[model samples]
Target: MFINKAFNMKYLSIFSILVFTLFSSCNNPSKTVNPEEILIQRIDSLNKAGYDITDYHAHLKGGLTIEELLEHSRTSGIRYGVAVNCGVGFPVQNDSALSAYYRSMKDYPVYQGMQAEGREWSTLFSADSVALFDYVFTDAMTFFDKEGRRNRLWMKDEVFIDDPEDFMEYLVTQIETILSTEKIDIYVNSSFLPDTLQSKYNELWTNERMQRVVTALKNNNIAMEINSRYKIPSAKFIKLAKAAGVKFTLGTNNTDANLGYLEYGLEMIRECDLKPEDFWKCKK
Candidate 1:
């Protein structure tokens, strides 16, 4: 009887080991979730639901050819708005150059955009030339601070922050002035801060400051860009802007060829309860 019991126990132990190995293989980490697949599905669902998703701040930089852009658009299911930087330092400086750029891209199915750089862009480009594009956008990153210093927020060397609070207030005023004065349809790189102040973005960008900027955008009929590169204009700010009836746009603001699928903006859509009607579409 004892011999028979030991033989049965050995078989039972082997059976248990086999079952565990099978379940372990099935639940292996290597068979993990496909985030790319999930992302594609999410985009597909949104597109099917009548969301005209488009990235209105893509650039043709870093060997990113127009043909490549078209192919990416086809595969990604997101449209593009090819913009040329228009200002003193940029390639398209004058009205002639701007017009030529537009003419070159006119036959394409994408929206031609003018990325107005610096405060002097209005002085450089003609109104007729500016009107040639599908839409125009600008950001307050290029502005003079209280010290009369041209503080380009993106440039670490140029940004000056003597007092964080005072600098933030200055930024808010600059945004207000840009919205009120600039002839722009959309504002890209919204709510951006310098590297030093970036970590304290939440603290520096106070309620009053955000409200001021949002009110300016609403009053001037400008759309706010939800930038994917920086993932900025926080959910709180977006919510406030939505409450104030401000429209939103998605932007990759790409510096390279790898133009993402606007993942951050899509996340914002679900988080901030944004709908199709909340987006700003360029009506040509």
Candidate 2:
């Protein structure tokens, strides 16, 4: 009787172990939750919220032709605005080149844009040709300081900040000048600071500074770009701009072909409670 009881106990232990193993395997959280599915759900959520998602600053760099870009955009459920940089140093500098660029892009269904690089873009291209594109955008990255030295805010060597206070003032003024003077539809890379002063972003970008930029955009009826690449112009700035009735546009500003969905812009949209009406769209 004792030997039979011990044999039965051993069999019971084996059965328990098998049951535990099966349960754990079936309940594995990692296997049960699919990341791809979650991403798709999030994309669907945005769509349901009436968000007309578009990546307005995509480029055909890194051997990704226009056709491939359109294909990727279609699959990702994002519309694209193809832009050509036209200014003093870029490929399409002169009026003829600008016209040719416009002609080339006219074949595609994508919204054509002209990225006005450098302050000289205003004089380089004619207004008639500039109006042909769907939209135009420029950043405050390049400007001439009071001393007449040209400061390219992105590059460390080219940037000049004499005094933090004075530099902030000048930067805000330059932005205001750009917004008031330039006839661009969207202001890309808004409120971007140089590497030297970027560490103090919160401090340097004070309420007064932000208000100046926001007011300029509002008065000029220009849309601000929510750039995904730099992920800049913080939530505070966006919120303030929104409160002041400034419109916004989403952009990746990609240097390469790998255009991921507008991650940061989408986050800002949710975080800032941006409505469809808050965004700007090209009518034509």
Candidate 3:
């Protein structure tokens, strides 16, 4: 009887261990989930958070046709405003070219934009032609400085900064002039600094100086662009502008086909806690 009892106890212990193993196997959590799947979930969360992001400054440069861009936009959950650079030295300089450009883009379900290059763009294209585009945008990037010297901030040779203080003042004035003068719906590449003065952006762009530009934008009813490629017009500037009732838009200003979703713009929206109402709307 004792031997039989001991054998029964051993069999019961073996059965208990087998049951636990099967239960654990059935309830095991996966150790690795696909990165793409996680990214999709994150993207869904972003969309849910009420940020209907639209990139207003994408380009079809680098051999990227409109069809290819549309395909990319559909998958990325980003609507695009494909901008054509229209001014002297650009392909779409005159009214005929501008008309053709606008007509060609009619089939695409994207906002067509005119990126006015240089101050001469105002005289180069007539008001009627300019108004045909969904939106028009320009930057203070190329302007005549205080000394009557034309300065293109992007190029090292074209830029001149003798005194940092003087340069900052001049740059601010130039921005205000552009905002007040240009008949642009959006101000692209806002607050861009020359390479020499770029490192001291925060220090140089004081509240007083920023306010001047902000006020100008407000008065002219121009929306500032949060440019992704440059990652410029720092968060501080954006917050200040928002408080001043100046609106903003997201732009990639892509030089190639690979324009990532406005990552920097999204970051600014989160960091600044921007709402949908804070963005500027094009005339639909």
Most accurate candidate by TM-score:
1
- Give the better candidate number (2 or 3) by TM-score: 2
Screening candidate 3 with a backbone cut-off below 3 angstroms (N, C-alpha, C), the clashing residue pairs are none
Residue pairs clashing in model 2 are: none
Q: Which tens-of-lDDT digit does each residue in 66-87 have in candidate 1? A: 9999998888888999999999
lDDT of each: 0.93, 0.88, 0.87
Superposed by TM-score, candidate 1 places the C-alpha of residue 33 at a distance from the truth, in angstroms, of 6.7
Candidate 2 lDDT by residue in tens digits, 1-284: 99999999999999999999999998886876776456555666777788788888888787879999988867677889999988877888988998988898798979998899999999988889898888999999988889999988888899888799999998899899999999989999888888878789999999999999999999999999999988878999999999999999999888898887888887898899999999999888
Q: Could you arrange the candidates by lDDT from highest to lowest?
A: 1, 2, 3
Which has the better TM-score: candidate 1, or candidate 3?
A: 1
Instruction: Report the error of model 3 at residue 177, Å.
Output: 1.1
Error of 1 at 38 (Å): 2.0
Cα shift from native, residue 238, model 1 (Å): 0.5
> Among these predicted structures, which one has the highest lDDT?
1
